[model samples]
Target: MPALTLSRGVADWPEQGYDGWVLLGMVTLSLLPVIRLFLQTLNAGSIEVAGVSLSFAAASESAAEAVRTATLTENLDTPEDMPLERTSLRSILRALRRAHDSEVTVVDLRQGQTWWETRLFILIAGAARRDRTQAIAFVGERNGTPGTFLGWAPPSRLLAAHLRSDPLLSAAHERARAKTAAWQLGQPLPNPHASVTPSVMLPWGTNQSLPPVENQTPDPAFAFELYLQQNLDRPSPESGRLVTIQRLRELYEVFLVTDSIDAQTPDDAWAEVVLTASPRRFFAVTKAGKFKALIPRDALVAALVTRLVRAEDSPS
Candidate 1:
């Protein structure tokens, strides 16, 4: 009902009572070309939007150049019979060990954890192999200084370690040990296998030659102690909070480790290993902090190994 004025020296329109809807439509149609031009400018590289100028093309080129310059390692050559899962685990461990003293971003993806979906930048102060598995002893870094030592093991291994130390299982374990000894000496096993009939074959066969069982179960406390002994020569922080192995295990149990995309490109070999292995859980050797890092879920496992390996291979 009121006369409408258009900006940019356009004449005021009072025709048709200056219908607001028509004016709105006309304004939107006029903006279509400007919107198209803005998008084209963005794709062309440098562009200003909302008073902020950005050089997307240059940023992309810089990232590509960084990837090109990164030091990369050749895929590990392993025996055909060796499981790729084990190989990938080994690769990750090797990378962490090599990347010691370097910083990395760790994101906690575990639901309901203290830092769930939080990212922390941690320095890999040190790493030690534990009990021949893919487990490692990690040193916590804070404010660029190493403070506490922690141990990490696979979930199953950690559970087994705890079960071995459980007071309730002591008596049962001892009795089982005695029975195992008796069986090794050709004694009959209990219950279902107690009365061996001619139809049923003995578990150890007629020769009673049972395969040797190697007890290499990882012990977190022992591993921590070993780590401490290894670092005995290093000076301890004058004042820092000491963390228990149990607490460390509890914290690490819920988290998975991966490399930040900014660190390195995901390794195809490592990706293949992950695809073949299909591991449901992973752990990182990192310090506790509020640092942040990101990696695609699919690239999670591959990135850590590849980045660390690249860091190690990279010339200082």
Candidate 2:
């Protein structure tokens, strides 16, 4: 038998086809483990594979956990028995920063006050500053309180500022005020839930036999009017005729007129309105043109008809 000669050229590889197929099979089998390991690493929270490391799930979970913790702390009332920790201040600040743009109802729980006795505030401007030393600036209105207050309180004191999806008891409060106003004015009490003035009076007084006043024409202009309990602090030319701002441009105009007319006006007059901070309550600084006079937000007889807006033609 002649001695076998080995061919080294590329074209001669097919001659070793059986050995080549076996080598290819072994290489593919070896790579399958690496591919599976890569997939596993991707799915895992934290894993090291073949000199590479991944922590996708771990990082995501950490962020999610922080938010959940903050939310839980905010919603649940702090245990009366448990003492507050100094370290928790950092977490509170973090939560405030996250919820900066949103309004919150802060429940101050000190001095063993019961749930009803505990001071409640609707806080705006959630976090004042980023520094630990800085006090959080807030415009807060306590429940059943007459005036809106401006205060700089430590973040730690804001123990449970629960985020609310709706205006804080605004509709109910407005309806209650409207009913009271109608009784005082001797007009028919409007429907509790009706936005528009009702055609018929729902009998509501000590004696339910009061006759409905005839020829009552509800003025369309004053349809959204709020009957305030007290007059605004600032006096203007149109103050007595006014009942509510009614529009953004009107508010801007009223601010201008008041600032010009009032002797004791702040340099930044708009800041006064901002301090009220409740969306449902428009701070009528002064009155103008059949609009309601300003009073504390809590004393308003109806929900604010107009929202704060940036009007193109608004006075500077």
Candidate 3:
């Protein structure tokens, strides 16, 4: 049997595995700038300011002046909503050309379609390459806020590869490769919801029809596992843990949302969310890559049940 080692502070990751601290740390690091800038924007309310990007900026009309960020917008259009087709992006490029004549342009990587997961990235790259006038830079978002800045496509490929090859992103990348293989080779997709790990999304219920566990009370976690199998696009389960009723308790706090999805392939955009409930009871984690960001599924059923009971008990 192979040995399993786990560490909270260990930054070294295997080709495929989970590290709680790594996940949390990566997110925390990305969040620092977002927190600081958000504070600056809030404090700007009391002070006098002219039209500017944020309270941090002074008016400058130079070509290198502002780095327009898409995620900074309150209602950012998710990749699902964007028209990223090559032809469409080309049209946007032409339109942008006529409107703004500048030495450089900063575009959301999501819109540029150059991020690894987007099917249009390679296509978007061609367009970006052909643009003779303007140089481009890309920015990635964290928790609906902008932070990580991936530079222009031509130079950033190696850096992007390094970041995306990490355990979590690799899981998404591996899945994309498999689906691509299955499509090109016409191989049997034994499980359409297939993943590199036993996913929290649970796609096995269709193949497994075992009789109920005899004389045992229904386990919410087990039941939830079964529930997830019906949808294969959901996030894969974390390594080193079984989905148990006891495990599901972490997500039982009051929450305004109840949804989540896991990235299993390369074509979907990637995002991870951490919702720390009031008073630090526990944190709820959710992610969407190659799909819409959803509420966490690990504790979703429990959270929903909590909400329903609370709603029903209130005075009618």
Candidate 4:
């Protein structure tokens, strides 16, 4: 009876065609890895603050000059809900207007559409110095919202550490500082954001899913990667381990924006960059690149850093 039972069980296996089922299961398992890889590739997206692609093309010499003039003339530490001395503001508006021969137009990159008739407010703060770093906090939406974006000049080493881990931001901050510094130094600002990197603006139209001309133009993406590497290559004040992409993504929204989706895509105009420095934060934007200068993102940050240090050294 025992032998009969064993033979019956074995006989049922063939009757059920267990080998066929086994082969089918193996095939499914074998394809899973490939399927997963394909899905990952398909879902690839972009990373940009407030929906604007962080690229060199976004930077313009005239735009940077305009920003420099505005920053120099405007009150960098003006409080919200209060009107500052009109002299500087009017002068800034005049210079910017004459420089570009038009009214100032603030473009909300997050909305993907131009805010043609609305007014926008942006603030600039100072950054920490090596010997006496200030303690500034960033306000607004840290997760991804857009509101008063801020910039700061973190010491070079700290900036580099952030880069090895967070290439996108590191790239943005680096390029911004470099260009802005050049502008302040009376040197011609370069288009550092032009290096190719994947980015998707917020409020992107339905058709604006992946990067524009992604497959057709891979050079930009490669350029972005190179720009990021360059961030690491630069001299820094301190040294630390390189951060993984995942870790950097965690700190992605550190820019501290006030809201999200201020504009929409394809037909949008205007681009804004925020600088966050300890005890100080600021933002720079281009009214219209067609007739203006590139917003100096990095240079603004570095300037803020220097400003913050100077402020701290001054009497309270």
Which has the greatest lDDT?
1
Clashing pairs in 1: 119-291, 120-291, 121-291
Report, for every candidate in turn, its global Cα lDDT versus the true structure.
0.31, 0.29, 0.30, 0.31
- Between candidates 2 and 3, name the one with more favorable TM-score: 3
Per-residue lDDT of candidate 1, residues 1-316 (tens digit): 1324443136644455547677787776776565445435444444443444433222323333322111102222344333222342233333333433222222121211221000000111122212222222233443444323233333234334433433433333344344334344554433254223212124566432222212322222232222222222133331121223344454454442332122232233223333343353332212243222211222342333334345456665
lDDT of 2: 0.29
Residue 135's C-alpha lDDT in candidate 1? 28
Candidate 2 contains a number of clashing pairs equal to 6
Residue pairs with backbone atoms closer than 3 Å in model 2 (clashes): 242-291, 242-292, 243-291, 243-292, 244-291, 244-292
Per-residue lDDT for 1-316 in model 3, tens only? 0222343226444424554555666776776666545334434342222321221111111111232211211112334344332122223323233313433333444332222222222222222334432333334453454422333322133224422433543444444444333333332224343222122222433222211222332232232222222222234443223212222122121221223223342111111122222332112122332222212222332332333345456665
Q: Which one wins on TM-score?
A: 3
lDDT per residue for candidate 2 within 281-315, as digits (tens), equals: 22322222211122323322111111112122245
Point out the higher-scoring one by lDDT: 1 or 2: 1
lDDT of 3: 0.30
lDDT of 2 at 188: 50
> How well does candidate 2 match the true structure in TM-score terms?
0.17
Which runs in model 2 stand beyond 4 Å of their true positions?
1-78, 110-126, 130-316
- Per-candidate TM-scores read 0.19, 0.17, 0.22, 0.18
